[model samples]
Target: MEFSELLEQAGGAGLFQTLLLLTFILPCFMISFHVLLENFSASVPGHRCWTQLLDNGSVVPANITPEALLTISIPPGPNWEPDQCRRFRQPQWQLVDPNATTSSWNEADTEPCVDGWVYDRSTFTSTIVMKWDLVCSSQGLKPLSQSIFMSGILVGSFIWGLLSHRLGRKPMLSWSCLQTAVAGTGTTFAPTLLIYCGLRFVTAFGIAGIFLSALGLMVEWTTTSRRAVTLTVLACSSSAGQAALGGVAFALRDWQTLQLAVSVPFFAIFLISWWLPESARWLIIKGKPDQALQELRKVARINGHKEAKNLTIEVLMSSMEEEVASAKEPQSGLDLFRVPMLRKRSCPALVTSFSLLISLYGLVFDLQSLGRDIFLLQVLFGAMDILGRATTVLLLSFLGRRTILAGFQVMAGLCILANTLVPPDLQTLRVVLAVLGKGCFGISLTCLTIYRAELFPTTVRLVVLFFLPETRGLPLPDTVQDLESQKSTAAQGNRQEAVAVESTWF
Candidate 1:
């Protein structure tokens, strides 16, 4: 019997499992919010260089309109768009620009903004852009800071993935939650850009750990019947978090306050971490059957099984010997590519994964293209995410994931393609189709993440691939022997059929 089967016998998809699933729901939302944080925090607001300059002791009037000031002290860019960086060395006074095109404009001496930029704070009261003047000559800092933040997530995924496997999931999850709470919330108070970026990395590291551990635990704790539904629910939780971020960002207006609002939730999660369970399946793999059995017995008791007290450790340990004996030598990531059939299948999957990722991020980064309130669009996008996952949950019983994936992908393509035919003046129709496309994309992304994890032969390298929410249904072949066993079974069936046909002819 496999460990999966033993877990099934011990009431895998019961009340205990539901309780365990609830423990991870908050962590799912917290980690997902980090993925969307940069859109608000690093956004460059409407800005123009302050034109005021002191000539000895005289003051330039402060009440001048921006248009008049720009004419006096700024040169339009080469395309006749207002220049973002350079300004005239000395004011020309608006009276000189009597004509739109004149020789004087061509020969005007210009210098970079010596007096820093002034930002319009109508929507965003404070952001990294407004606070640090990451505009004009320093515009590159906005994207650079974001790049550093993403790099932290990339590196953290590897470290936390390995650490959770070595140090156990619950401990890593607890520590991550606590660390993220401290480091992330503390970032709001950082007085310098360098310190903020440093804290952002720490926050990324901790959240990565929390995300991986919580997701792994969620999948491991549930039975196959419940795994997809649980993952779908977690996906919805993530969308809700993103929606909450959009709404809170709209309300708070200041980047620091929004930062604190999002970061503080993890501390509450740290306290709740006490209730989360370490993977009993992993415990059994580690030769801790006694501990695993205790966890299962508690599960059985919560599930209202009277026989739980009599359920000995043997029930959990029974499958361990076969698992250990059947285990193969560890394979590196390249091995998946070394196998011909695997590579053929993987190439298309890789391309598809890349396409899905680009489309997902492109939609997220450019949500305002739909011509609606950014806050409302984000909430609708989140709602669409919720709708898509919920729809997937309902369809899973009637449709295979592969079939549903194809349908959703096709729908996404059609929606996007149809939008191109929509007239530019028909903003409402364009917005509707775009929203539908986004929803289709949301569904496709959710399915692809889970599907690929199930598709791949588990190898050390593949561990770095799928990191969001997860579902566990099919077990990966642990050894080449397992494949050979399957081949032998097919061969024996073929032989039996041949014998039966000859017997019938005779």
Candidate 2:
């Protein structure tokens, strides 16, 4: 019998697996909070030039309304509202007349706001835009900050991807969670935009590590029977976190407070990491049969499997002999490209992953363009994510992973592209398209997550690609051979027919 069969004898999907799943829920939710943090933290609010029209350098006056005072100091914008970036060179008292028309102000001389700008704080009491005066000419910094954070994630992916497999999953996860909590909360004290961007970059770096390490833990810990369901639950939890962020941001109303709120929980995740079980499969592959045996016995004890206590290291070692032999070869991320068969299969997945990320985040970060209440929009997008994942659960029963992945990606792209044809004035239609696009993207993401895990082995799965096999009810492939043999497994039985359809993408 294989190690997977032994795992079942030790009580598959029992108390041990249940506890492991519960441990991951918080980390998954907190990670989602950071993913959408900027939506509230860097939001741009309504604003106009701050021109002192009264004593005390105040725009508001006891004698005149703020709007009436703006008529004298500020110029009319394209929509007849106060110009946000520009103001009259001198007070134009004549424009205060009721007869003022577009022609009257069309030739008015105006200059950029030299002193500073005033913001409307009705929705958000404070944001990074308000803190740094990132308005008008400086407005570009808002997106740049998010871009910087993304670059950190990209850099960290390469670093953590290579290190986690070598060092171990739990340690990397704990360290990354601590790093994210520290850097994330540290953003509140940033005295300058540069410092804030630096802290956010570090925060994103830790986030990438956290995500990769957590994925490794999840894939290695669960049996095939629960893999898809487990992934769906995690995805749904992420959506719940995103939806919860809208409410949290609405209550906090300050960027500093919001940043701290989302970040501080990671500290708890770090503390909880000590209790998580190390992957026995990974231990055995690393030539630590004694440690693997101990971990397995612990699992069996927790799962109430008395027979497992009688098991010896020899039985454990023999069960994983194929995987242990495969691990003798040195491998790295480059191997994914160096191996012709691996390259042929991974390239499509790589392209699909890249395109999906671009489309999904492009839609996610552009929420303000929808012209609806931002809080409402955030919640709506999150709700659609939940709905999409729920839909994927049903579709997976009848559809191949490649078909679902490709189909959803195409549908999501169509929904987002279709939004371009809709007139801006039709706000409801545009929002509908955006929400549908998010839902499709969510389903695509869910499919991609499970599919990628199934395509590689435990050793290199963190870097890129997994075993080239379907993972519906089979054991995890700990080595390349373990994956290749799955092709024959699929052909051997009537129940395995669907596995062949799924693995054909390779």
- List the global CA lDDT of all models: 0.69, 0.82
lDDT for each residue of candidate 1 in 107-215, tens digit (9 for 90 to 100): 4477777877767778788898888889877888877776677678778777887777667788988999999999999999999989998999899889778877887
**TM-scores for candidates 1 onward, in order:** 0.83, 0.92
Report the CA-based lDDT of candidate 1 relative to the real structure. Answer: 0.69
Candidate 1 segments whose C-alpha is farther than 4 A from its true place = 53-67, 77-82, 94-102, 307-310, 326-328, 331-350, 368-372, 410-433, 456-506
Compared with the true structure, what per-residue lDDT tens digits does model 2 show for residues 214-282? 888887777676777777778888888888888898889989889999989989989998898777777
What RMSD, rounded to one decimal, does every model reach? 7.5, 3.8
